[model samples]
Target: MNPWVRLMSKNVANICIMLILPLVFIIIWFYLAKSIDNTVILPSPAMVLQLLSHPSENLISMGSLTNNIFISLLRVLAGYILAVMLAIPLGILMGYYAKIFQLFNTFVGLFRPIPPLAWVPLVLAWFGISSFATLTGVERGILFIYLNNIKLSMVFIIFIGAFYPVLTSAIYGVKNVKKTLIDSARVLGASESDIFFKILIPAAKPSIVNGMRIGLGVAWMCLVSAEMLPGSLSGIGYLITHAYTIARTDVVIAGMISIGVVGALMDTLFRIFEEKKFKWQRLIR
Candidate 1:
């Protein structure tokens, strides 16, 4: 069999096999819902599907389900992009320059372990009602007035959640490039700019991709948590919270499922790009 054909067939088979577990899970979920006798505690898959089918009607108060998802996606993209922009350069500097690494190592070490949720209170306090009102010159204590502007707070939290993973991974990736490779490029009279961009970055592509994958997941999680907090009126997390408040567990479940599906789709796209971008690595292997 041709190698490319075999690879394609193997991937298809793996996907088919992987799908079975989710189907099994759905079956178990259906059985559990039937046995539990409480729709509020655990809505059936059918009930969730029903809500999903008419998401506009079900989620009208929070805007349509599509709108909520779009809002969340925007937040995730904004934060993740910001994180990547800052992390990549800083990571490269840290990895290539010992002084830079020493300067940031202690700070990164101290804060990297802190959960994104822990920062929520601080974020809210900084960018919440008071901050918004102050910035916009609106009088304080006006309810629902500054709610929309709090999107920045959510974006920042998501950035914090995503930043460290990419930074650390990128730093490691750059550092892991064999010193001999750099030395070789130097000996060949390649300029520092050429060596760094042409040699270092290409070699670190896989690690950087891995970091981005992880960071994207973390960014999504942080977006949800941030949106669930006070002042958030839109996004999937807000939809979930609103549904729960109204005893609409089905909507909550649907929202959760939407997050998972969208996250998986984004990851799949990223993986495809990674594969195409680094196809040469496979040939080398």
Candidate 2:
């Protein structure tokens, strides 16, 4: 088979796995739900959907369930975006500078291990019961994650979840170029900028795209943890908590389903972006 045809076949296989596996799991879940004879504990998918569709004061009002979902999403995006923005530059600096890296290593390690919940009280006191406060608390934790990720971005984390693995890969791709190539460029009297942009960045294209996909995955994965702020109504996490308080199993399950869907959507979007942005990067090998 042609290499391109083989690559396309592999892509199709991967997509099929992602789609079919989940549906099979859901079927098993529904079967188990019926077999257990416990409506309260494991509500079937249909039950959760019923709850989602039924009108309730908490779910139906304009300031309804969707409001919470949107609010939580906004918080996650804001916090994640801010953390990533700050992480990338600082990461690049640390990657390039020994003095700067050493100066902040201790501080990052000091509180990096602290749990997100641990900071809730302090963040609440400082920022109060607002979106800012909740997200700020989440921000602190993610900042630490990003900081650590950035510190390693140039090393290996960039390959996994650093700010943008693909970008980092692209950066290193050029740096790893044969010395002869660079020397030849210098012999040609090309400027430093010319050698860098013309050679280095283009070489790192695949790695750079990989980094973005990884970063986006991390951000989406952390969405729930980031939303666990102290205060206010709304969000999948908050919805789960609020529903649990009233012993509303249906509402809680509905929230879980919503969260799952949202998480899947995020991953789906990342995949789509990668496909569009780096279609050629996909390799059968």
Candidate 3:
């Protein structure tokens, strides 16, 4: 048997198994909708599909589906990127310097247990609840209007939510690098910067990637919560909240499915990159 063929067959089988539960769920949903005669409580899969197809019209006054999704994606990316930029260097330092870790460990320990959504009230209070028009100058244009205090607050919330996982993972990754390896590089007359850039970072790539994946998932969760706030006017979370208020269960479901699909897609892409870029890690494992 050819190895490539065998791998392809295995992948196909896994995909089929992955799809079975969703198919069964849809079937049960359809049956319940017909049997219960209550679209409000349990909309058929078809109803949700109809709403998804006409998202521009059905998404509760929130622009088109594309616009809402793009907004959410942008917020998540902005916060996630900021979190990564801050976490990696700081985390590396914490791991490399015992004194630095000792100084920050108390703060990290205090904050780690707090859920991101718990900060929502504080964030809203700090940023103010003014309308975008009232907050910004008209000369700043639509982009500035869209990125008003409310949106900045949401991004900040997401950054806090995403920061811990990446930071902790990076610290763990750097700490776990073998002391022997560092000693060997130093013995070879390698500078501290050379040791870190060449030895520590490369060895820790897998852990860093894992941290990014976890942070991204948390970031999405934070984005949804932020968008559901009273001042928020767009995004999938806002669409879900708005639809629920109007008793549009189908629209709510559609928004949820959209979020799940987008999250899954992003994770899948990251996984592909990890597998390709870290092939050596797999071989070692």
Task: For candidate 1, write residues 185-227 as lDDT tens digits.
Answer: 9999999999989999989878888899899988987877878
Candidate models: Cα lDDT each: 0.85, 0.57, 0.85
Each model's number of backbone clashes? 0, 8, 0
Best prediction by TM-score = 3
- Candidate 1 pairs with clashing backbones: none
Model 3, runs deviating above 4 Å: 1-11, 55-58, 129-140
- Candidate RMSDs in Å, in order, are 4.1, 8.7, 2.4
- TM-score of every model? 0.87, 0.65, 0.91
**Model 2: residues >4 Å from true position, as ranges?**
1-20, 52-65, 97-99, 102-115, 130-190, 193-209, 280-285
Q: Which candidate model has the greater lDDT, 2 or 3?
A: 3
| Candidate 2 residue pairs in clash (backbone atoms < 3 Å) | 164-211, 165-211, 166-207, 166-208, 166-209, 166-211, 167-208, 170-204
Compose the digit string of candidate 3's lDDT tens values, residues 36-85.
98988988888889877876673566677777888788878878999999
The list of candidate 1 runs beyond 4 A from truth reads 1-15, 58-60, 130-150
The lDDT, on a scale of 0 to 1, for candidate 3 is 0.85
